[model samples]
Target chain A: MPVIKARVTVTLKNGVLDPQGKAIEHALDGLGFGGIGSVRQGKVFDVEIEGADKAKAEADLNAMCEKLLANTVIENYSVTLI
Target chain B: MKSAVVLLPGLNRDRDMIAALTKISGKAPVTVWQTDTEIPDVDLIAIPGGFSFGDYLRCGAIAARMPVMRAVAEKAAKGVQVVGVCNGFQILVEAGLLPGALMRNTSLKFVCREVKLEIANANTAFTRNYAAGQVIRCPVAHHDGNYFTDPETLARIEGEGQVVFRYAEGTNPNGSINDIAGIINEKGNVLGLMPHPENLIETAHGGNDGRALFESALGLPKAA
Candidate 1:
């Protein structure tokens, strides 16, 4: 069985307020970074699983995201195999 | 009435909740640990506030998936009364026992202060002692106390009288939608609120405004 690597990204859903992102946007403006349309903060997780089955690994990663990696209520998640 | 308090690591308010319950009910509440798969029979289950699992992934997100939470969910399903305060409220939402989600305060700062709370609906088991539209003082302390939900869900909850408490008198500390400070489940047995009612249940605490909530849930006569 080969080791499968994956990455999961989680971001706040649209229309949900992002206070941390807004703070960063303000800080960037203070630093003279101009013309920034907007800013949104998110989280990324790099995971490694020991398995030769790609489909099973993908399924497991999605399950992990649904159960723990991301809160589906206010956040969206994506999984990419590497 | 017999009561129990859920215990999880990084939670700092178990002692306060236990003391409040003990003082109010004249009996010490049993403490349930995070890994426990079964909870003893009790009338009320209270989950106190704190930075559970260090607020990893999200506030209350990690703790919500613990074994004890499954037991709590089971108890809630059976029509037993459940109350969650602060981070406890966050856990309930994360565990899918309650609607909506608590997010980072819109001010991006942790708020630890007193706020006025209005009894939006006094008909539930938790707020029966207070009159609808009555305002009381309670302390709220948290970084992610901002409550939010989709428009449809919000409308439904509002229409159903599930919105039990609201921040009143321009004291919405976390930018919660509709100034919501507390809410109950559709069945009205489960309640999750951001304020610390336990902290204000006695005259020594400066007021006993929060005592009636416990009295209501515990089926005790209204406090004199």
Candidate 2:
């Protein structure tokens, strides 16, 4: 079995309201970081799998994200395989 | 012994929870839908786990603002017991019944499994059946089970003993700090936990650890 490394990152799409990110940005502003423009919060998933094919792993990862990891509507995701 | 279980639109577990509670309480709890304008008399109020509002817009964020939830909040202000599980947990956090928000699991998976929970506080209505520092196994199925809170809030929760069920050591799975699996309000009336106790209430379920949770309210023995 070949071990495939995959990372899935979930981010709030532009025009979506990220309360957590906004809160962080506000805190930074309060800390005198006046130049802070914007921040979008997201989820990062790091998974290592044992498999023979990287392509199969990528497809499976996508399925997982669609069914569970990413909310699809509010969040956009990009998957990377190593 | 009379309890009411609120049913949010898209709430799929309300019936399952009702069965579990009825089996334990000897009476079916009343179900209050999200659009309802009234909350009847009941000793305990439960927000069952489900894809409320199709899990749209940050899990329970939308459902937290439902009309029935407003009523539930009013009841809670009078110290009525409120319990939320999974999506229900998200609702509690969104409703501010409990502190902190559930984020994506560090593993980024919709993990569904049986995991051990360390009962940190045995003094509350929900966990009184278990001994403090005791460990028990239960099931969890969720993607946003990762719990996060500010340092100050974390310290406060620890000092106040509001941290109830913590994940067994080194088994966080979700990257929750302090391995928190559940928490209660400062008053100990509202509880939010990620694990599905309703899934483990029967002897036929291969485990009966969850029976203790519902039984705790009635001061009954562990079903296992």
Pick the TM-score winner. Answer: 1
Per-residue accuracy of model 2 over B144-210 as CA lDDT, tens digit each? 8888776788899999999999999566768787899899999888999998898888878787788
lDDT of 1 by residue, B1-224 (tens): 99999999999999999999999999999999999999999999999999999999899999999999999999999999999999999999999999999999999889999999999999999999999999999999999999999999999999999999999999999999999999999999999999999999998999989999999999998888
True contacts kept of 1: 0.80
Clashes of each: 0, 0
Give the candidate number with the greatest lDDT: 1
- Measured by TM-score, how close is model 1 to the native structure? 0.99
| Distance from true location, Cα of B46 in model 2, Å | 1.1
Q: Stretches of candidate 1 above 4 Å error? A: none
The 10 consecutive residues of candidate 2 chain B with the worst lDDT sum are B215-224
Q: Model 2: which residue pairs collide?
A: none
What candidate 2 gets wrong by more than 4 Å, as runs, is A1-82, B219-224
Q: Write the per-residue lDDT of candidate 2 for residues A1-82, one digit (tens) a residue.
A: 6688989998866654455687778889999998988987777899998987888888999997775666554468989986
What are the per-model DockQ values? 0.85, 0.03
